[model samples]
Target: MEYVAGNVANKAGVRLLMACLLAKLHNPLVDVRKPYTRIGGSDSFSGRKYDERYIADFINANALPCNSTSAFLTPAFRNRNAPLVMGLELEGRPPQLYTYVLELLDDVHNRRVEPENLLAEIIRWLLINRNEQQQRIESLLKTLRTTHGAIPLSSEAIVGLIEKHMSLKGTSRIPVLIVAAAYQAAGQYLLEMNLPLQAHNAADVQTGALGDVEITFVGDGKVVTSYEMKDRHVTRGDIDRALQKLEETRKRVDNYIFITTDRIDEQVQDYARSLYTQTDGIEFVILDCIGFLRHYLHLFHRVRTEFLEAYQSLLLAEPSSSVSQAVKEAFLSMRHATEAG
Candidate 1:
């Protein structure tokens, strides 16, 4: 597929920006994963270590040697499944390019590619195309400075600033917001209860491994709660897997909450209810995103300055202009009511 430059750049930028924002707003002292750092470098078997050596050796052993007159390699010949030597001479990619291309090939072998790799490629392309990446970063920093000055203590506006500069998607935007909100709420809860609380993602909760969030809280001698966020489309199989994961780490968490954005269909809700009923070790609470908004409407109001500003900015700046007026009005009114109190 032809990579659409604007879309690609936006997605890459937002992923990085969101990671940074979440870490800053929620877990300031914690080292959240950064984009574009070396991934798959954990062990020798990861193929990152072997890729260059293997490719070089293969090329030398099999490629036909010729004088410097030939074009380094033809695109078609380079991409073929031939021996490394033949492919290298045919592709004529320089040593640095080879590193990236080999990494790309290794991704194909493993059936997954890290977002950072794509980000690196996008940055490389941008640098080639009149140094756009650096320019965009500069633009983002400038926008951040201007917006913060206008709306001090505006978390929502700060998020919106990053979104505008980075071009984040609505789907990606909500998760980051939810995580930030959860962290803020949990932190306050900890202070009020005079105890620490832990948070974990689905992956760590599943493997009985403590997530960075969980470790940070527990190491501080605080009580920890585990929450798993679910989208409208989550399936029964997904729930089953999550349950299994929770069961694996039952001793670590004090309470388990399942947060969902979509209304649960009756059958699925029934299954969840039954499963929780039967399970003794884990306490389960299902929180609907819509209901949470209503019950905590006041909290929403308290946080309206930042959240509403973000919502409005997104509505105005997004390309489709498809966000509903009612949604915007409701949130704005909620914010206004909270501030009035």
Candidate 2:
């Protein structure tokens, strides 16, 4: 006799009521991408009836295709959907909730490849600009013997050009780049001076312990001068370490020079001077940023006459056997492309 909606099937009147209730309950769901103007009306009762104009327009207006920095680093290109933004956007009392949004955005934007891009661009710029600068110097060198009006090589110009293209601050790669450039410049200077270089390559600069002696010349099988490049702040402790390391090669080396960035404090300068004054048997010298710049400037002037031609020849001569791998590779690629055409 109990007439529950689900169990009362024997009675015809109760069966009809339950059928209507179930039909109403199972009405088709509304599409979220549509507009629902009327609520609890005929539209609500009807099945699968909705307008999608407003939602589509809203999406089109608000969303934009992300212009990523690097095509290779984009998440869309990697076949991944947009990541969910969890509670990381909220500002907590002590700290905020962990958010993967920034990380996600970074991957989408591809900012990680920026360094290599900048490096490649800078190298191309340097090669072209330095070549032009060398041409100007070549003209001046012709008058070197006759006139004092010859234009001087400006180290500031070179350094300024590099700084203009790339900010060396907060970059870990700048030191290595600068040191490598210095080594290249030094090798060119030696070549112009007609001195026989024992070893001058990327290996000499990159694949060694910091502060280790880099002897350039081997005359009569003895090292004449040992050079060390430091792209950091020179501390007394660093100097002590360098001096200790140099002790191992003191018998073979006649002189030792440490070159570093211009930020050398007075303490370091004083310590180096003291070491130079007190030490015997071998000469010790420190070339701070300014000193090194001046040294390079002199080298530029010394080899100005043959700089550009020599540089081009060197690039084409031995592309694989240089410290400037990126530049060399770029140049070689261009050469190959041109030849292919």
Candidate 3:
């Protein structure tokens, strides 16, 4: 039972890790058992220690003769008879020794199970109870939020924001929620700049534009902005493609913002700068994880309690009668993003 509990904890930690990656949440890798960190996994074992004099004497006594490959030792004869009595057989040699060796081999084989089989069994169990496990986790989160003022999150606040500013509900709402949250916060950033928001989008609401999130400033509405939030590592190819896409929309939108969870390389920045100078009417800017968080943190601060609830809810939420390939693809993308991050 102890062993089963330990393995279940390990598997549960892995599941939480996978979920965090899907939600673009950053958490530290933690040691599994002792003094559990924010999450759990085992660290490498420490080196062994022994008494020096006893170890040296034992080694000297049992040391093999130099350059002797044929040298081997045999076990005492008293233990040999038990295997023969246990039905282990010998073909040509004396019955005792062969039987004893066979018995030892059988014992070893019976004592050890294949690791792959154990993992397969554990994963099967997880799949069977995934929904129930998620519900329990949500309940735990709710309890943590309510019982502790130190917990620092409120679903009531998140739900309020969602109800007031967002038209999203259920699983399909989350991606839109993310987009919406970022969009609303970007508006706050604009307001901070002393520019009033002339027009804005409800989360995922778009004007048939190329960007994921859009906002127009109070001034002529010609000073418009669009933000694309990609929770993944930024690459050179990604920058090039974004610049290419921005070129098409530059005639209409004044600013095209690219936000990612990756550290943008200097070369990508240089390329973007070169494009920026070449472009006539539009501004091109790139923001990394820190930058995106600076704006997105507003929503996080507002809906801290319900944020993870919303994430888990969306993860299990299905918008259609059947799960689609796109949903699986999005999850895969987030998984890769987490690994890369």
Worst 10 residues of 2 by lDDT: 1-10
Q: For candidate 2, write residues 211-321 as lDDT tens digits.
A: 333444423434456556565776788767667765544443556677666476887777777765556656666676445544565656654323323433443333122
The estimated TM-scores of all candidates read: 0.43, 0.37, 0.35
**Model 2, which residues run further than 4 Å from truth?**
1-156, 163-166, 169-213, 218-221, 249-252, 299-302, 305-341
lDDT of 3: 0.38
lDDT of 3 by residue, 13-103 (tens): 2222122222221112322111112222342111011112222233234331111110011122111222222353434333443443334
lDDT of 1 by residue, 1-341 (tens): 01322332122222222232233233333222221123222221212112233322432343211111111122422223332221243233333443334344344234474434553554444334323433443454444444443434344443333333223233322432443343444444334222222222224644554322231252365435555556654456755766676556555455555566667666765566666446665455566654554444345445544444544454333221122222333333333333333
Better of 2 and 3 by lDDT: 3
Instruction: Say which prediction, candidate 2 or candidate 3, comes out ahead on TM-score.
Output: 2
Answer with 1 or 2, whichever has the higher TM-score: 1
